[model samples]
Target: MNNPEEKEITFVMPFGPQHPASGHFNAMITCAGENVVDLKAYPGYLHRGFEKLMEYRTHVQNTMLSDRVCILDPFSNEMAYVHAAEISSGVEAPERAKYIRAIMAELGRILSHLTWIGIMSSALGLESGAKIAWGDREKIIRLNEVITGGRLYPCYFMPGGVRDDITGDMAGEISRVLDTLEDKGKLYDDFVFFNTTFTTRTNGIGVINAEDAVALGATGPTLRATGMGSDVRKDEPYDAYPCVDLEIVTMEKGDAYSRSMVRRGEIAASISLIRQLLQKMPAGDFKVKWPMTKKVPPGETYFCCEAARGELCFHMVSDGTDKPYRVKIRGPSFSLALAVFPYLSRGVQIADIPAIYWSLDPCPADMDR
Candidate 1:
């Protein structure tokens, strides 16, 4: 026991690999009683050194690595890496294929966000919200099964195009699924989105202004919530984004609530974009039909896609060989996860830590690569 006149002491707590809220990484936060004084992130528990492995594998084989690397997202990872390889190889997919790729990518975002909603809601003690969100997410996963013949990690996207094309009836089936999803979105609004407890709990916590967000390298909904209306899909259109229409949704507050709202808005926007893609998709050859074992010309290129999280980027270098010379991946979560420390300053309650972290939607696998 200390004397009454003594100053308060600060200690560290590791909110960790075994934490109930976050999955793998650990947060070492210095706390003075209930308030956090400083914080740091320690990631790498999920590290598989994925980039180095890509160097030794054939170009076609690396697709498997990229798609699986970021477990939370799907098409964006495969699309980004493939686009880079295509650039180096002087190959392009058919117009119809681009539209289909766009549709699949947007579907990936919807499902990823639904999973996010379930996990985040569960973190906040919203049990009903979790069940409803996950239950609806399954509907999208079923759609993936219909399209790609696989649920998670579809392995559907290839270098020049998708592994297969959608049938007319299958397209109608997806449209109906989106209709059900829209209704479910309204249910989410009713139960969780506008809930008093949720709003109050998230409103002011983990606030980061636009400048601070950019300085810390935050991206995706995390940066958009700060009123920076920047999205790779809008600013730098790739695949069918050039032909289709969508909004770069942003919120002014830059708080946890704003971030959640941004993701919520994106879900609806993606549904609309998918409908347009399916309707306007031109009829043509699905692919250029390049050999998987062919060598790419000696060159280097970078490609970026607006993934479910943010700009999932890839850099590829080829030396006129079937295998890549080098591959580098840039994941938004790595910087966004580190950015949380700035928000954990003195006077922030320890309880806000998990909420703030989830708001960034950190995926440690992205960092490990």
Candidate 2:
């Protein structure tokens, strides 16, 4: 029962700023006949000018701002920036400090992946999965608070070492939290992965081939979904990664389903890493003694870390001053956001755009910063 004389009118829909699920930004989609013709992402609504602001602040002061780059994975920024300063000034962290850094980094990874899984489930209308994912995330947040005295933005990593030491009680608490999460993780997998509706909605949707993924500069789980095993933790071992065993998780199908599965697998791996780190942690000075003046020599240094999103690189040029001469934060979210827009607009319904967008896990603040 179709009308021969009827015509479809294309319209643009704005989804953002105050939507139920569009985290931290707004997205506009132009649709014609149920298919999205174009999509534009606006992220300046909360621009804080982090890069330019870092140039005006001292190296120590910049650590506070780095955490705001990606609110979910703030520790990764802390480690990356501190490591950059450490490398530039030829100051190597002690053995115990390196182990502590690894623990914090892995814990941050678990928390970030959990948040993404929860948000994605909510986007797909899987309310039960979202609840379970976020509830378990609370345990990880508690552990972060126990170690660094801060839940979201710890700022615990200094130039040469950590801000405080992880004592016996803190280590035991982390182990107990991991045990609880392991039990909860199994139930979550059964509810989400085994559910027919969840699979039908996500499987084979927003498919990206290996070649396309590589050409578009995709990294982390997005690249791993295409069967590429390129993780900075494995390729370039930094801090305590060399002391512990590590594994890379990858999937053959580069689709929404594959990306979600890869993230789940990474969460499991991060838990294993944390448990091992706690058991074999050494005893030493938590903080290295540095000059009170806090001056870094004149030089340019490049440092990269495997953030929860992807590879986060920091290129800093110092002029023997307290503040940096130039600082550039190469966030992986920027590249992933660009790759998603072009591929998501054509031949897909407007309803599917949210799934595709969430699969990319684009942090708008990271992109605009």
Candidate 3:
């Protein structure tokens, strides 16, 4: 207790690992007079030190760990790493294999986005929105199981191409899932976007201008939300992306609401892209023959893919050994984590923390890996 004439001083509060709405990371926020003054992000609570571990394992073994980086979008990491390896070894996957890879990647994108929607809605206290998003997400996961015999970490990608071919029934099942998701997407829009509470909480909050977005290395929906028509799939054009037509989606405002809308719009685009890939998919060998054990040439290669989160890139250095000398992953979440502190600190309320974090879609595993 203090005297009536005495003044009170505010201090910092840490919100984190166990916090209901903090997502998978921890944050320390300092406040003065009901306003956050400084915020710092502390990841690595879930870090697995994957890059260091990869050095001790063979190239094939490393793929298993790569999936752990971005648990939600494992396929993207697998594809990027495997593609880098292929480039280093001067090996090209069969044309059919490339198409199959594209299909898998797109399916993974849908699943990842659905998961993000569910998580975001849950953070915002929108129970119905979370349920609908997750209900749709499970279908995509089932599709993944059908394709790769596993739901979360399928390990379906390989150096030469994919691990296996997609069955005719599986391809049809994917189409059906897309249709179901399309119908549910409209419901999501009506229930989540049209809700007054959601609109007020998200709209015009944590806004990032277009020029600042570029300077800060923001990518994916975050950058797209700022009206930048940039997408790695279109500009870099890796794997089956070059073979398929794509439309990059963008929004005028870089606010939380705009980011959500951008993701919503891209989900539809991904469904269409998957449909096109399946419809035009040609029949051929799904795997190219390679030595059971081979050494990567002494060289370095870099490759990137437009993952659900953003542009996921990988740089590999091979020292003419079966195991890579070094492998570095450039995950998109790093940028999100770095940018979040400044935006979330002072001017925002505790309730807005989750909303802002979800808008950025921080995947701590990716950031700390």
Candidate 4:
């Protein structure tokens, strides 16, 4: 019943804007019989003009705004922002405050990984794993709430140091949480890492070599998974990182499994850093006293740190005023989600899309910001 002159066209599907796997991001996928032929990533679903907005707010006020840059790892944003401001203003945080910053940054890493594990598990249809990961993640949230007075956005790290000191009770609580998470690591391996189904889905999928990853602007686990030991912390030590013993985690395969492994290893590394920080923490003032109307000297400076996703930097310019004249945030997710995701999606099966996407751990908010 077909006409001789009829022509057939390929089907193009919209992956998301509201899809669970897409996480408020969208991708235009062209499939050739269940195999992806092409993909185009569409970000900016959630944009708040943070760069422009930062200019209007004072440097201290902008700390709160930085917390919103990436809800999953707000501390990094705060760290980078404050560090840039501190450099411009020629302010040095106390030794104890530097230790506190390192400790909090590591905690943020663990928190971010926990959230990624839960969400990534759900994307792969492992609801039980998701629940367990989220439940355990809550403990850290409660711990941070007690230490920094904010569950998600601590807003604790300022230009010169942290907002307050980590007293005996707070340190003890952090130690307790670290112990609990360390024990839970074995459970994660059994449930998610060693689970046969997970391995089957992720083992050799979405492969990207180290050279290709770097060319595509990949960072964090996405770059490290390809046998690259490059890490902002190790390469350019900041805060108390110079004083602490730290190691960069890397893998050879450069597949989804490798990426997951890098993050897994990093969780353990973060835990170790926290322990070291606690043992070596010095007793001193927490933060430098500054007035609310403090103004940064006219200068341009850049500061970067090892965020959960990757190298997060803030390039700030001051016009000898309380407010920054210009601010730019280089979020890793911007490249990972928009550039790397599409590159990895080609030739992948429709079923493997979610696995590959979540493996990169792309935060849409970070991309849009």
Give per-residue lDDT, candidate 2, residue 122. Answer: 88
Model 3 CA lDDT for position 112: 84
Candidate 2, clashing residue pairs?
none
Give the per-residue lDDT digits (tens) of candidate 1, residues 191-256.
788987778889988888988888888788988999999899998898899887787789999988
lDDT scores for all predictions? 0.85, 0.85, 0.84, 0.91
lDDT of 3 by residue, 1-369 (tens): 769996656788877777465656888888765667778888878778888898888777887888888889989999998898899999999888888888888888888888888888888888888888888888988888888988899888888888889876988899888998888766888778767778888998888888887777788898899999989999989888888889788999889999988888888898899998998888888888756466999999989898888889999999998888999999998887767446544587656777788888878889889
Q: Write the per-residue lDDT of candidate 4 for residues 1-369, one digit (tens) a residue.
A: 879896554679888888586777999999887889999988878899999999999988999999999999988999999899899989899999999999999999999999999988898888878998999889999988998999998999987899988986899999899999999888999899888888899999999999999998899999999999989999989999998889789999999999999999999999999999999999989999766669888989888898999989999989999999999999999999999999999999988999999999989889998
TM per candidate: 0.96, 0.97, 0.96, 0.97
lDDT of 2: 0.85
CA displacement after TM-score superposition, residue 298 of candidate 2 (Å)? 1.4
Residues 48-163 of candidate 2: C-alpha lDDT, one tens digit per residue: 88888988888778888898899889988998898998888889888888889999999999999988878888888888888988998899898888899999999888888988
Cα deviation of 59, candidate 4, in Å:
0.5
- Name the candidate that leads on lDDT: 4
Candidate 1, position 179, lDDT: 94
